[model samples]
Target: MERIKIHFAYDGTDFAGYQVQLEKRTVQLVIEQALAKIHRQDIKVFTSGRTDSGVHAIDQVIHFNTPLTLDCSAWRNALQTLLPIDIQIKHVEKVDESFHARKSAKEKIYRYQIINQREYDLFKRMYEWHVIKPINIDQVKIAAKRIEGTHDFTAFSASKSNVKGDKTRTIHAIDVLEEFGRIVIEVRGDGFLTHMVRIIVGTLVEIGIGRRDQSCIDRAFATLDRQVVGLTAPSHGLYLWKVVY
Candidate 1:
């Protein structure tokens, strides 16, 4: 069997999420179906990570094994032609059998986008979270620094999650950037817990709007309690920005 790695991006608004579920449209379902058409057999894919419903991806990595052989360019062109318009095949390459997409990933970067004006961008509504009130970008930046470095991220994870084992993860950086009219929070970390980036974004937004203070970060970390954290930002505004191996 030859191991093949694929890189793709998707507009997640139309699908349920990244994972396949019964009676629901999913990214994995569509891609696997397309691959099956080419190979005339079912193909199983291993992804770097799963994104929630309505979450987009700038670059998502996956790998699978197949007996049928094809060159990288042919593989890319073939898959793109079979997949939907919303799902784009970026690159396809043959990789070593030892390489696993999820396990080989050394770091991941996720970005949460927010429009900080009273009126939202009509066209970009599906891609960005709209904040009716103005927020202090300075406060948000200060609060974001607290989340950087290694720590226990128990308070930032989703309240209802299936995560097991250690809750400790090292966050390399949390950068808040003002691009055009959008406030984008890009978080690069060794790994993330379920809804970790969303929860952290919500907490930073609270601090920006004066609903919470910077000390909240310390409190949440000390308490190790989800109740101490802020809201979980909506899925639509989040994007799986990049993955590093």
Candidate 2:
């Protein structure tokens, strides 16, 4: 058997999530089915990470072991023909047998977009979180700066999560930019807990709207309590931007 790495992107509007579910459409399931058809064997995929329901990905990576020997481009194009319109296989390459996508990843970046205007963009409704009220980008940055180091992120993660690791993770950066009536929050971390990025965005949104002070972020980090943070922003606005190895 040979190991191959694949890079892909998908719009997660219809799928349940990246992981396979009992009876729901998923990015992993679709790819696994396509691989099974092409290889004529049971092919399993190991992903860089998981995204929640309605969350999209731009450069998600995965690896699989296959018995067939085929050109890398042929493998990519053939899988694209089998996948749905929302999912696209971007590239394929042969890799060392020990290359595990998730384990080899050094960090992951996720971006959340918010439409900060009165009227929503119809085509972008399913891709962003819309906020009618005005938001102060500077205030969001102030809150963002408070959480930019190795700290326990329990306050910014969903109460019910299956993430297994030390809660203390390093956040390399949290950047907030406003452009074209949209607010973008980019977070890069070594790893993330389930819904952690969305919750961090929600906490910053509260600070931007004057509902919470920037100091509250410090308190939340010090306490490591989930109740200290705000709501988890909707999944639609979140995207797995990239995975760094």
Candidate 3:
């Protein structure tokens, strides 16, 4: 058997999520289906992370062990040809048998985009979250600074999240950048709880809109109360930017 690593990207608007569901359409299911068709066997692929519904990915990585002895490009080309239009395999490399995509990841980067405008464009509606209210960019920055370093982030996850083990995670950095009328919130962390990045962005958005003060950020963290945090920003605006190993 040979272990193969695949770098891929997908527009997640149409699928349920990255995990394989029994009945619902999902990214993992689609990829497995395609791989099954191409290789004439039931091949299961392991991903770096499970992205929720409506989330996009640019540098998502995955690996699988296969019995076939084909070239790396053969696997990539075959999967691309069988997969849907929204998903594409960027690159494929043969790795050592012990390589595991999820466990080997050192850091993951996620970006959430907010359209700060009065009106929305048709083309951008499905890709970006539009916040029409006036914002204080400085407040967003202030809140972002507090996001850096190691901390327990239980307050920034959804109530329905079934995150097992410890609630503590280290955020390497958080950056807020404005580009072409869009406010982009980028977060780099070792790992994230369910909806953690979106909740963080939502809280920052509230601070930007003056609904919540910068002090509220500390309060939420200290209390570990989900109710006190900002809403989970829509999944459409969130993207899994990369997984650094």
Candidate 4:
């Protein structure tokens, strides 16, 4: 058997989350079904990470083992033909058998988009969070900077996450950028807990709108209480931008 790595992108709006669920359409289930058809057996796939429902991906990574001896290009073409239109395989290559997608990942970058205008763009309604109030960019920047570095991110994580272990994670950077009337928040981290990025963005937005103090991030780190953080930004606005291995 050979281990294959596949890089793909998908529009997560129509399907459930990346993982498989009974009686639900999901990216993993669809891809697995496609692989089974090609391999004539059950083929399990592993992703770099699980993206929440309505959270799109620009370059998501997955790896699977197959006994078939097809080249990378052939594998890509076959998967593309079998997969749905919304899910596109960008590239494929053979990898060492030891490589595991989720465990081998070094860092991940997530981007959250916000529209800070009163008149929402009809084209961007599904992809961006529209906030009617004017947000203070400078304040958001300051808050973003404060969130950089390693911290116990329990406050920013979902309270009911099934992950059992230390919640401490390292934030390599949090960049706030504005382009064409859209506010973009990009967070690069070693690892993230469930809903961590959305919670951070929501807190920063609150700080930008003067609802939360600039020091709220610091307080959240110190307190480690979910209630101390700001709202959980809607999942639709979040995107899994990249995964560094």
Candidate 5:
């Protein structure tokens, strides 16, 4: 058997999420179905991480074992032909059998996009969060800086998530930038809890809109309460920008 690694991207607008689910279309399900056809048997793929519904990905990674030996370039070409148009295979290569996708990941970068303009662009409705109110970029930057470094991110995670064990996570860096009419918030971290990036973006948006002060982030960390944080920014605005191993 040979282990293969693939780098891919997907538009999550039409899928339930990355994982397979009953009675729902998902990125994983489609990819597996296509692989099953090629391998002439059932095949399972492991991903670096899962993205919530409507959360797109630009550089997602996955690995799977197969009995059939084939060139990496041929595997990429065949998989691209079989998979749906919304999912694109970016690169593929053979790897050691011990290289698991999720466990081998060193870091991940996520980006939240916002269009802070009066009128919403119909074309960008699916990809960006449209906020009509003018945002204070300076305040957003200050809040982003405060969220960097290691801390317990339970306050930023979804209350409904049943994640056990430590909630502590280290955020290596955060960049808040404005280009054209879009405000982009990029965060690089070792790992993340459910909705953590979205929640952080929401809190920053509150700071930008004057709804909350910069100190609110500190308070959220001190209290470890989800309610103390700002709104959970919608999933559509969040993207899995890259996964580093």
Candidate 6:
């Protein structure tokens, strides 16, 4: 079988999520439908990971096997003609059969956006988490620093997440930056559990607003309890910013 690799981006607002459900609209379902139109058969695709409902992915990677031979450009254009406007085919290429999208990924960067101002901006309503209270950027920075290295992040993930086994993941860096009336939190990590990045943002936001302190991060880790952690941030504000292989 010939393996083809694809790099794609999606708005993720109108769809259910990345993975296909029985009836719900999804990125995978639409892509596969488009592939079916071209290949004249069902084509199974494997993604790096599934994004929750309303979660956006800027560069979601996937790989699929095909029996027919077609150039990279031909595949890209053909898929685009069948896909909806919300999804875009960024790049496509033929890859070695050994390259598995999920297993081969080395890093992923997630971005969460929050509007720190009190008044809400109608234009940014759908894309950002609007925070009415004042946030101390310095406090947010302090908490971000504490969890920069490797640790078992069991406390920072959704308890009901289907992903099981080791909760240990290395966080390469977390940068808290303010720009254009919004606060952006970017986390680079080797891997993430369900709602992992959203949970991290929620924890930091709590500290910035004085509801929690840096100690909570430690307590959550030491106890390995989700109850010690902050609420999971809204899904719309989170984005799978990048994936590195």
Report the error of model 6 at residue 173, Å.
Answer: 0.7
- Give one digit per residue, the lDDT tens place, for model 3 in 1-245: 89999999999999999998889999999998988887789988889989999999999999999888999888888889999999978999999977889999999999999998789877988788989998799989989998788888888988878997788999999999988878999999999999999999999999999998888778877998998879989999999999998
Please say which candidate is ahead in TM-score: 1 or 3. Answer: 1
**Error of model 2, residue 172, in angstroms:** 0.4
Q: All candidates' lDDT scores? A: 0.93, 0.90, 0.91, 0.93, 0.93, 0.91
**Model 1: CA > 4 A from native:** none
Give candidate 4's TM-score: 0.98
What is candidate 6's lDDT per residue for 2-23, written digit by digit as tens? Answer: 8999999988789899999999
Model 5: per-residue lDDT, tens digit, 1-245? 99999999999899899988898999999999999999999988999999999999999999999998999889998999999999989999899977999999999999999999899889989899999889999999989999999999999999987789999999999999887769999999999999999999999999999999888899999999998889999888889999999
> What residue pairs are clashing in model 4?
none
Alpha-carbon lDDT of model 4: 0.93
Residue pair clashes in candidate 6: none
Which candidate do you rate higher for lDDT, 3 or 5? 5
RMSD of 3: 1.0
Q: Can you tell me which runs of candidate 5 are displaced by over 4 Å? A: none
How many clashes show up per model?
0, 0, 0, 0, 0, 0
Give candidate 1's whole-model lDDT: 0.93
lDDT of 6 at 65: 97
Clash pairs (backbone) in predicted model 3: none
> Which is the better candidate, 3 or 4, if ranked by lDDT?
4
Error of 3 at 124 (Å): 0.9
